[model samples]
Target chain A: MDKRFWVLLGLFLLMTAAGLLLGEARFVFANASLICLSCIGIQ
Target chain B: MAFFARFTDALARLRRAPVQLTSTLLWNSYFLAPWLKNVPCPGFNCYSCPLAITACPIGTLQHFIIIRRVPLYLLGVLGLIGTLFGRTACGWTCPFGFLQDLLYKVPLPKWRVSNRWAPARYVIFALLVVIIPFIALEPWFCKLCPAGALEAGLPMIALQADLRELTGLLFAVKMVILALFLLWMMVTSRPFCRFVCPLGTIYGPFNRLSGMRLHFEESRCQHCDLCRHVCPTGLYPPEEIDTAGCIRCMECLKACPHGALQSCATGTSCTERSHA
Candidate 1:
């Protein structure tokens, strides 16, 4: 609607595309399986 | 008029119930059995929970930081949600927030903290979520996170026998924090969201930029302070409507006797064109 909103949306899209292109998606997928024990402070 | 106002309030609660229930089910998708585990939830549902369907973003952030990798996916997903609805997810979707709401409904004496201390959550975001994780090479915030303890640690330990044997000083410490938060919620509503949650901190700034927002009509003048009284987080509604502290619960809208408050998708105030 506003210029700022459009700019923010553009930036978000660009970053998301960059993340996908750089293979960060694979990293995220790999780490998803291991239970985040640190998140529960167990580690 | 009183009957109408009461009806409006009931309707709002009814609207909120379905959202809260659906969110809870989605987050705790153990019933779905590993359907969406690879995806990260925007809210603070712990990944280690047996029932959790998605990874926790904060946990994912810390993991990436530990591995010396950029958390592009996590950042992108969080960015998308923040840009759209801001902390509305925290208010309506987070299981921990829902738990806090239920805890506050317990008949206990309530307390209100000074709004001056509101910046403490940002400090936590900076220190525990960002700095400590980068330096310590671990999720330092998670060690002390009450949500992690309540949702993941305790549940997993109860369900799995091996996890109980793994308990030690760290588990005890996490339990203490969870107990304190549980007690605090009984006295003060949504204490974590107002004072601690790192995810809330990340989403807070987006409140100003988000598409959805609360519109306040200054023309309808009756400063009855009912909006302030109804706010679970004790925020003064009109002035702080777009501030990071607002969770977008819309209680103030229900409490507005003059129908001065409304939530709008457009940045422009709907009241300017019509009484919508």
Candidate 2:
């Protein structure tokens, strides 16, 4: 581990926090909770 | 006596078997928590699996792309994992990777995918998962994802008559893709992780920058080739320990009889010879 690791950790933490504030987790749930028909390879 | 010896050899040679098996069960334990769909696990699982509990990171990323939204949460979560442990998740926690591991264990001669074609996964990440979804307003990768086919498509079609009626060319294509990979994994080592996985694409670059590291002691090395022999990704650890191609399976660490490969995380002292 070096400065790069720490720097990136902080960067990603901020990105996650920002994503949380942006309500992206809800989007993830909405998509993931339901079986995605497209993902199931159905037309 | 030979059968007993073979059994003993297999037991002693087990690497990440416990963790991998446990993770596969946990990931597929849908009844544990459907609410965890919002959270993404650190592997390439298909969220659509009947038994899957959390979101698939690659699938989630693709959905976000299709919807014209940035998947910051997914990306950040994956980035955190990648920064801390690199591609260790692929080796230890990925259900699909475990499948490949099991497939390669079948009694057969084995071959290796070339290191030169490793960069092809990046192209897959860019085109199939990202660019195509954004442009076409479809999760194109998901439509053809082998993991999705194995985990959800085949099962859904098998269990539901309506789903069977709905199956079409798209499902057949995904099945063929899945079949090719299944056959390929039997003859080679982790061909999908090495040449196709987009999640591995995100984590691969972080190997050079992750908190965890592989420490190579040059003084102890006789270049015995044991590490490379045990490596599922077929990397020669001495020369390519933390290369983007490495999934950080730690078979090298376990297989080095001379103890040349040591694991060092943020707290451990690998300052002198750490690959990262």
Predicted model with the maximum TM-score: 2
Candidate 1 ranges beyond 4 A from true positions: B1-14, B271-276
Docking level of model 2: medium
Question: Whose lDDT is greatest here?
Answer: 2
**Per-residue alpha-carbon lDDT of candidate 1 for residues B218-241, written as tens digits (9 for 90 to 100):** 878499999998887788887888
Pairs that collide in candidate 2 are none
TM-score of 1: 0.91
Considering every candidate listed, which one attains the maximal DockQ? Answer: 2
Question: Would you give me the overall lDDT of model 1?
Answer: 0.77
Candidate 1 at residue B234, lDDT?
A: 83
How well does chain A score by TM in each candidate? Answer: 0.82, 0.86
Where does the lowest 10-residue lDDT sum fall in candidate 2 chain B? B1-10
- Taking every candidate in turn, the Cα RMSD to the unseen true structure, in Å, is 4.6, 6.6
Which residue pairs in model 1 clash with each other? none
